[model samples]
Structures are given as structure tokens and as C-alpha cells.
Target: MDLNTAADAHALTPLLNCLLREVAEPAAEHGEGTHRLRGSGRLLRVRGGRRPARPELRRADGWHPLSHSELVELTSGELRRYTGVSNDELPVDMADSRATVAALLAARAQAAPPRDPYLLSEQSLVMGHPHHPAPKARGGAPAASWLPYAPEAYARFPLVFLALREDQVAEEGGPSAATAIDSLADALDGPRPPAGYRLLPAHPWQLELVGARRAVREAFADGRLLRLGGSRLPAWPTASIRTLYVPDPAADLFVKFSLDVRITNDVRRLWRHDLLTLRRTDAAAEEGFAALRRTGSDAAWLADRGYRTAGFAFEELAVLVRDGLHAHVLPGATPLLAAALAEGEPGSPLARTADPAGWWRRYLRQVVPPVLELFARHGVVLEAHLQNTLVAFDASGMPVQALFRDAEGVKLLRDLDRPAAWQRLVYCLVVNHLMEIGGALAERHPDVSPFVWPAVREEFLRYDAARGLPETAELLAASSLPAKANLLLRWTRADGAAARYLPLPNPLRD
Candidate 1:
């Protein structure tokens, strides 16, 4: 397909999905693939499946097909009317999302995908967040600004190195009590800094955005900071555009840098509040995964060890160090992003399995157990959604293990009430994660699809029986699942950190 056509198809599914789920009601009288906007009481039609497509509006004369831009207009109009609110920015964001996909398609045509299956999986999400209104929007910036660093484009580049004077450094897990961030200068193999200076790696895109600030410029103008060129080797941008995977054999690690631009919900900057609580959150997650290890589960947690940033531009220049896959992944097994699997990535173990039932059983056993176990045992609520997870496949394409990351999204039991935590867990694990994966699996193997939900129920039943947890019983008894209202949230222009949920039919009960 041509880039525009492809981009339209890519962008339309998620927007249509949001509109159908959040803004529209079933127009059962009109027929299947038809829905009426609850806000406007107008009918719309879409060919539905795992990816809804080819949306049309029921006009006075007949059905009129809607183009991508027209669909964005309809969504903007519906949201504006529904909420009794006006949003000028969201419409631009929605349009920018489609434009961004077109740019990514153009770039991917010329870019070579990485040789590694893991890297390929990470870069495969051209259409991310199935329910997000504008998943691909890069803070509404022009495509040229973000295209070079896009994971979708298979982009990789050297880290821009800078020397921070020792006195000007503000670090948490480094210095007196050191983590990887302390000695990262030497490990990165960047040019040596002066006797009183420490090396800091930065995202080039971020530097460009923040370089003009008086504080940043003053540091460079004086002697507090010095530029030391880029790193010798390039790092691959992962599915999360800001976090990168450094492929160095000797000093392999994932480095997350602050990007001022917003991607999905929040600006990708590593805010100071999250930075302050990083160690605490990482420790809790580590403990939860360690408990899984004691029970003979090989699931791993990629630790977010430490971070480094200059005091002048704290959030702007902050860089976080995360654990590499070397120590965690099983031998002879390749780890693939869970999100890519949900997208029905071709030639993957999830796609290649002859016995879909068996593969799904293995996948559920590896994925479902840890999330429930951690919440029940450790009071640790992991954001166990598809993007935050990785599943490793052994030879013959059998799933052997699952590993999870993102300490910044972790929530401790002490902070929130049990009910709220449980709700978040269900939303992330059941609705967002399992539902998408099951749909993908079903799409590929329709015959055995009947057993997928049964398998999930059986696994949860087994866990509930073993642990004697009440939440499992409540979940099974509940008629609906909490689906995050991404469309509604975007329409309201609410804080991304705060999520609102709408009820979705609980597939577990099916």
C-alpha cells in the first residue's frame, strides 16, 4: 500500500476503536458494524475485527465513507459536543498522529531493520497503543524533528557526551552510595573529562530542545560544563523512543534520557518527582520478582539502577540507567517485545505455533502468574501492559520466560489503597495486556480461539486456589473489566498520570 493509504489504515483503527468504545453506542437497528454516537445520536459504520477499519457515517441520503482527516474531524466534533468542552490542541494532536505515521512509513521504506529479533520487535510498533487517540503523536512537533530518532524508523545514534563539573552534579543513586550511574562515564567509553568533571551522556534531540535556555547556555559559557563529542558506538532506540538499548558487549545497558516532547499521554521528560522515587520503586519491583524466583519462576525484572543529570537543567538532561538483557534472558532464547506479539508480528513464535492452545497456555502460565503473585504476595502493582513486558522464546518457538521493566510506572502498596491498586492491576494485566494478545492469537487460529479465554480462567483459578486470594474471586465474579478511557481522557485534557476507566465486557467470564 502507498504510505498515505497505509498510514490511514494504521491511524484509523485506534481512533475508530476509541470512538466506538467510549463515545458511541451500538446502533443495533442499523445492523452490525454500525454504531450511534451517544453524544450526537448520529450513526456511524465500521468493518470491525481486531483492527476496525473503513469507517462511514450514516447521512440523510446514505452512508458516506470518511477519510482519515474526516474521521479526525468527526472525533473532534463528537468529543467537543459530548463533553461540552472545546479543545483546539487535541484536534491538532490527532491530525499530527496521522501525519507522523506517514513520515514513519516513508522512513521505514529506506531504513534497514536490525538483525536482532529483539530489536526488530522493539521497532515494529508503527501503530502503537490500540486504544490511544493519538499514540504516534510526538508532542505535535513536525515529522522532521522526530523521524531520525524514531524506533519505527530503526534509528540509532551515538550518545552526545558532556562533562559536568563535580560541584554542579546532582545525583541520587551515584556518588556516596553508588550505582551504575556513578562510573557510567568510563563504561560508555566517551572522551575523558577533566580532573574536576564527570561525564554525562545526553540525548541529542533533547539537547537541541533545551540548549537555548539561559541556564544551559550559561553553564556552557562558563566552565561548569564542557562538550565531549558522542559515544563511539550507536544505541538502538527501543519501542519507547526515549529509552535506548546499547548493544556494546562490554558495557551493555539501556539508557533512558529526558525528551521534552510528549508521545502518548505525558511529556517524555524524566520528571524530578519520579526520579526521587526511582530507587524505592525499583527496589520494590526487584523484591517482587525475587519472590517469583523463590517459587521457581524464572521471570526477571530489568532494574533501573541510577540516573545522572546536570543541576542547571535537571529534568531536561536527566539520564537513567537500566539493566541489560544479558544477565536476565535465558540461554538460547530470544526475547521479543510483548507489544509486537500483540500486533501479530510475522514469523514470531506466537504466529508460528502449530498448537495455538498449547502456546497460549505456556504464554499465560509465564505472564499471568507473576502479576497476580506479586500483587498478592508483595503488594507491588506492576504496570504489566504489553509495552512494559517481554517474553523469551526457546528453540522450536516455545515461550519459556517473561521479563518486565519500567520502574517509573511501578506503584507501592504503601502509597495507595488495596482496591485502587487492584483496579489498576486488572486494567493493565487483563484488559490491556491479555485481551490484545488473545485477540491476536484468535485472529491467526480461529478454530482453537474458543479455548483462549478458558485457558486464562483456568490459570487464574489455579492461582486463586493456591494463594487463597479474594481478589481473584471478585475478578471472576465481576461482570466487567476496567478499560482505560484514553479517548475520553484525551478529550478532557486531563493529567496523564490520573487515569479514568470505562467498563468493558469481561472476556474472562466468556
Candidate 2:
């Protein structure tokens, strides 16, 4: 495929898969070249599976081709017909997503990827959230507004710093938060905060978007908030664009900011409720990881250490400090984003591996055990999706450890019914995380694909035998896995936090 064709294909795959999986069903396949979209009874042809699949619709003349724009038009028409409800905004968002991918492709052509495997892995998600309809949409913002901060474009910039008056500072996880922020301040070269004000860091893009708000402006005028300046050191934006990685030796921490832009399903804001209950969730995760460690598991939890923000502009101004790689990673092991492993990046161990089966086995060993142990033993449901988990590989490029992050996504058993929690766990861990990685590996080595699911089944069985959990039998026997219905969720304009799932065929079943 040529460059533009390739980029369009990369952009269209997720959109088509989402439409097919959520709103339409697959009808009789026409050998290898064509299939049918069930709702409209329109025959279609596609070249891929659930991700980045190229699609075409059949017409009276012959097999008609669909570009990204044409695909959006088709999807909109099909959804309107299927639901009897039209979403004008969704079609716009879908178009915007395609445009954003085009922009990223253009920028990537001119930019040099980071040399560090970790940074490369973090920034390599050109096509993100494979099942989401509009993964790269930037809330309809202009490309210039977000390109400088985009991870896919390999963009990195310094954070803007602010000084919030002492009384206006609202924070939780006090000691840890203060220390982490203070460390960041020490490393940054910026204007000193005035006498009564404490240092508060702001995302430059966020400041540009929300600094003119009445509350923020009033604080600046009333000596409540002061613009200190930007930091000297640049932070690398991770796959989760709102979170940034600072490679400073003095203050090594991932700083997550509240970006007002809509990314995927939600506004990328660090919401007040999540911040208020963060410590509780984090404490539970820490306890859960501790218990898992006792089982001699090498899995680790990348704690969300703390957060700092102004009381006046809490969610908008909030910043979360998460544990950095240097502290948590195993010695002599290079850590990489699990999502990047599936997506493919420069210097990926998966792509370079000579022993696909052995590598896949090591990956399963590190990723599966901890998630199961934490769920069964501590009732801590980790959102162990590919983006939330990192795998550290030893010198031979075999996965040595699995590290999970993001406390905001964690749910304790007390908060949810066992069945619901188990479903969420199965969806996030098995469907979202394992399935993607396994598919990627399979593509690289189709011969080993058949063995992959059996190995995963075996791993779960062994864990079940040791733990004696009845849920294990159910999981192994289940005909379908819970797959999050992102397309439907967005179509109905439902709250992003409210996840709805549909049954997808369970590959783990015998």
C-alpha cells in the first residue's frame, strides 16, 4: 500500500470493527473477499479483523471501495437505520478522528522517534484504543493546538508551572503528594512562587484552553494564583496522552494533568470524585499488590503517589503523581508499554524475538498470574488493560515482570457485585489486554497462534487449581467474553464511566 492508503487503512479499521461488533452482525461470508453487514443487509469486504481493518461496501455495479470519509458516511447511515437515532456529533467525531490520524502520520514522517525503548513504547500508539470509534479525536480542536503535545508525533514540551495561594490549595494524599510535587519543583527552572503561594504545575495546553476562565483569571488577579513559567526539562507524553513522563534523575515521576479535551470516551480531566477517593482505591491496590508479592509473583503496582491542585479549579488544575519506572522496574530490565507491544514500535522485543512461543509464554506468565491473584485474593479489580500495564523485559528480551498503574480505574469488591466485578475483570484483563497482544503475536507468527489460547487456558487452570475458586470453572466454560460496547455507549451519549458490555466469543473456551 502507498503512504496515504496505508494511513487511511490504519484510521478506518477501528471505526468499521466498532460498527460491526456493536450495531451490526456478520452474515454469510463470501469466501475470503467479502462478508455482509447484518443490519442493512449490505454486503461488505474487509481485509482485517477487530483492529485497523480495511473495509469496502458492495453496490449494484460491483464491489464499491470506501475511503475513510466514505466509511464515516456509511457508518452514520447504518447506525441511524439500526438505532432509529441519529448522532450528528458522533459522525463529526469520527471524521475528526480520521483527520487527527492523518495529522499524526504527517508529523511522524518529519519527526524522529525516541531512542529509548520505554519512551518509544509509550509514544508508539498511532492507532489507539482499537475498538473505540473515535480514539484520536481532540474534541474538535485544530491540529496545531494538540500536535505539539501528541505522543504519536513524538512531541515533547515543558510543563507550565503555577503558584497557588496556600489557602486555595486543595490536595489529598498530603505527604506523598507534597514531596513528589516538591521534587518536581526542585528539578524545574522557573520563576519562584510568591511568599504565601505554593508551587502548582499546569499542562501548557490546558492552561491555554482554560486559563482565561473566570475562576482562574480571578485567582491570578487576586494574588491567589500566579503564573510562574514553564519547566526547562521536557516531559514525554505517554500513550495515555494526558499523562507525561519526566526523565529527570532528581524527580522521576509520571505527572498526569487534567486536559479538558475529549479523548476517546471521556473528557481527559482528573475529576474531583476520582481524586477524592483516590487514596482509598490506591491503598487497596497497594494492599492487593503486597499480597500478590507474598506469593513470589514479580508483578508490581505503579502507585499513583499523590496529587496537587487549586481548590478553585480543582479538576481543571489537578495533577497526579504516579510512580516512575526507575524505582519500580526490576534491575537490568527495560520496561515497555504493553499496548505498544501489540501496536508495534521501534525496537520492540516482540518483533525482534527469535523464539515466539517462549516469548509468548513468558509474557503470559508475567501478566496473567498477578491479575488473577489480586482479584481472587484481595478483591482488587485492576484495570489491567494494555495501556494500564507495562512489561519489563530482561536482556534476552523475555518478559520478566508486569507492572500495572491507574488507581482511578480500580474497583473494590465492596463497591461492585462479584459477578459484575468479575465481568469487568474478565473484559479488561482477558478481552482488552491479552487478546490484543495475542493477536499481534499471532500475526507475527501464525504457526504459534493456535498454541497461544491453550497456553492462556492452561495458566488460568493452574491458578484455579491452587486457589480453588469456583469462578474459574465458569470462566473456562463460558461461551462468550464480556466486550465493552464503546460504540453503543457513545451512540446513546451515556456517561463515559458507565461501561456496557456485550458477549464476544471466548477464545479460551475448549
Candidate 3:
């Protein structure tokens, strides 16, 4: 396939998968080229199942292949007919998502990838959130506007520095002596702050988008905030687009900034309430990781150290500092994004492994135990979905560590019902994270597929004796696993935090 066709196919796969899994069912297959959509009684066909699905619609004359735009139109019409709910914006977003993927593909061709394996893995998620309909959509913004900051394009740029007046500064939590936010200032190549002002960094792209807001304008006008140019060191955007990684040898750190665009279901902003409880959540995660380490698991949680922002633009301008991989990673080991591992990016250890079964076992040993221990022993439910987890591999390309991040998504048992928290954990850790990796491995080594789930069950059994989790028996015996309904959630326009799940067949069940 040509580059444009290849890009369209990658973009169309997730959209079609979301529509099929969430809204439609299969009625019949005619040979390998045609099937019927159960909801609309419309005949359709695709090249693959779940992902990389190339859709075609049956017509009067013959089977008509649908382009990405045509597939969006078909999906919109089917959803309207199936649910009688008309959505105008989703179609536009769908088109925007396809266009964005095309732009990313084009840009990646011209740009050079980061030499660092970690950064390359971070930027490798060109086809993001494999199950979400509009994962790449940037709130319908022009591709030119966001491409400079797009991770998939391997784009890296300097941060915009700001000087905030003392009284206007708002912050929460405290940083460890080693990973303090103040240390970041030493690397800035921007104008010096005025004598009484404190240094704060803002994402340059975000500043361009929100600089015109009344609060930001007033702050600048009244000298509450001063623009001090950009940083000297370039920051690499990770898979999570809003977060950037600075590769400073002396003070390496990951800085997360608030972007006002809707990525997937939610607007990517640092909400005030999340910031208020940041310390509690982060402390819980740190404690949870420590407990796991005592159990001899090489799992770590990247601490979300303090944030700094103006009181008026708390969410929009807020910047969060996180621990860099250099300090936390195992000796002689390289960390890679778990999602990229599943998706089979260049330099992925999974792709290069000589022994798939042994590698899979090592991966399970590193990943599963820590998550289960944290949930049962510590009451900390990590959002251990593929995107949030990082798998570090030793020199031999065997899995050596599993590191989890993102304090915002953590749920404590004290805050949520234990049963509910366990369910969410199962969904995030198993259904969303492990299943994808297992599927990728199976695709690579179909001969060893039979051993996959049996091994997972054995791993669970190893933990069952000590923790005795209430859901243990049910998890092993359940007919279905909870799968998040991303398509329906977006269709119903529900709050992003309000997750609703549908039951999918549990693969681990005997």
C-alpha cells in the first residue's frame, strides 16, 4: 500500500472496531469479503478483526470499498439509524482524526526519530488508543497548529518560561530533594525573572492557544505574569501528548502541561480538584509501590512531584513535575512504553525476542504480581492500562521491571467501594493492558498461544494464598470480563470520568 492508503487504513481500524464492538454485531459472513451489520441489517465486510480493519459496504452492483471518509459517513448513518441519536460533532471529529493521522504519517517521514530507545517508544504511538473511535482527533484543530508538539511526529521543542508574581502563584505537594521543580530552572535558556517574581514554565503550544484568555491577558497586563522566552533544552513529547520529557543529564524530569483540546473523551487540562488531592493520591501510590518492592517485585511508581501555576489559570497553565526514568530504571536496562510494545514498534523488545514463551513469562512475572499486590494489600488501584505502564528490559531483551505512572487515575479503597475498585483494577490491568500484549504475542507466535492464559491463571494462583482477594474466585470462574465501552460513552456524551463497561468473554476461564 502507498503511504496515504497505509495511513488511512491505520486510522480507519480503530474507528471501525469501536463502531462494530460497541454498536453493531455480525450476522453472517459471505466468503471472506462480506458480512452483515446486525443493527442496521446492512451488509459490510472488513479485512481484519478488531484492529487494522479495512471496511467495505455492499452495494447494488458489488462490494464497494469504503475510504476513511466514506467509512465515517457510513458509521454515522448506522449509529443514527441504530440508536435514533443524531450526533453532528462526532462525524466531524472522525474526519479530523483521519486527517490528523495522515498529517502525522507525512511528518514522521520527514523527521528523524530520537536516538534514545525510551523516547522512540514514547513517540511510536501513531495509531493511539486502539479501541477509541477518535483517538488522534485534536478538537478539530488544524494539523499545522499541533504537529510541532505532536509526539507521533517525533517533534521536540523548548518550553515557554513565565515569571509569576508571588501572590498569584498556586501550588500543591512537595518534591523530593532530588526531583524538585526549582532544579528545572537551572536548565532554562530564557530571560531572567524580575527580582520579586518566581520562575514558572508553560508549554509554548498551550500559551499560543490560551494566551488570549481574559485571565491570562489581565495577568500579563497587570504584571502578575511575565513572558520569559523558551527553554534552551528541547523537551520530547511522550505518548501522552500533554507530557514532555527533558533529557537533562543533571536534572532530568518529565513535565506535564495542560492543553485545552479534547483528546479522546476528556479535555486535556489539569483540573483544579485533581491538583487539590494530588499529594494524597501520589503518597498512596508511593506507599503502594514500596509495599510491592518489599514483596521483591521490581515495580516502581513515577512520583508526580509538585506543580506550579498562576491562581487564575490553575488548570490551563499548570505544570506538573514527574520523576524521570534515568533514576528509577534498573541498571543496564532500557524502559519502553508498554503500549508501544504491544503495537510492535521498531526497537521493541517483543519484536526481537528469540524465545516468545520465556519473554511472555518474564513479562507476566514483572507486571501481574505488583498490580495484584497493590490492589489487595495497599488499597491503591493503579490505572495500569497499557499507556500508563512501562516495561523495562535487560540487555538480553527479557522483561526486568514494570513501572506505573499517572497519579490522577488512582482510586483508593477508602474513597471507593472495595468491590468496585477491584473491578476497575481488573478492567485496567487485565482487559485493557494484558489482553493487548497477549494478543500481540499470540499473533507473533501462534504456536505458543495455548500456554498464555494458563500461565496467567498460575500467576494469579501464586498470589491467591496470601491476599485472598474477594474477587479471586469469581475472577477465575467468570464467564465474562468487564470491557470499557468507549464508543457508547462518547455517543452518550457522558463525563469521561464516568466509565461504563460491557461484559466480554473472559479468556482465562477454563
Ranking by lDDT: 1, 2, 3
Q: Taking the tens digit of each residue's C-alpha lDDT, what string does model 3 give over 1-510?
A: 777897788788888778767776565556663556655777888875446476778888988888888988888887787777888888888888888888999999999999989999999998899888888999888888999999999999998888999898888765462236667677778667788887888888899889999999999999999888777889999998999998888678888989999999999999999988888999998998887777677799999987888889889889998888887899999999999987778557887788989999999989988888888888889999998999999999999999999998898889998878988999999999988898888877787789889888877887787667667788999999998888778877889999989888898898
TM-score of each: 0.98, 0.97, 0.97
lDDT of 2 by residue, 1-510 (tens): 666776687778888778777776655556564556645878877776546365778888987778999988887787777777879898899989888988999999999998888999898898888898898899888999999999999989998888899999888886877888877777567667878888898888889889899999899899898878878888989999999999888888899999998899999899999998999999999998888778788799989978889988999899999988888888999999999988866458888789999998899989988888888888899999999999999999999999999999999999999999999999999999999999988887788988889989988998888886678889989999999999888988889989999899999899
Backbone clash count for every predicted candidate, in the order shown? 0, 1, 0
The TM-score measured for candidate 3 stands at 0.97
In candidate 2, stretches whose alpha carbon ends up further than 4 angstroms from where it belongs are 1-3, 50-52
Candidate 3 residue runs with Cα over 4 Å from true position:
28-35, 175-179
**lDDT of model number 3:** 0.85
RMSD per prediction, one decimal? 1.5, 1.4, 1.7
Model 2 clash pairs are: 13-53
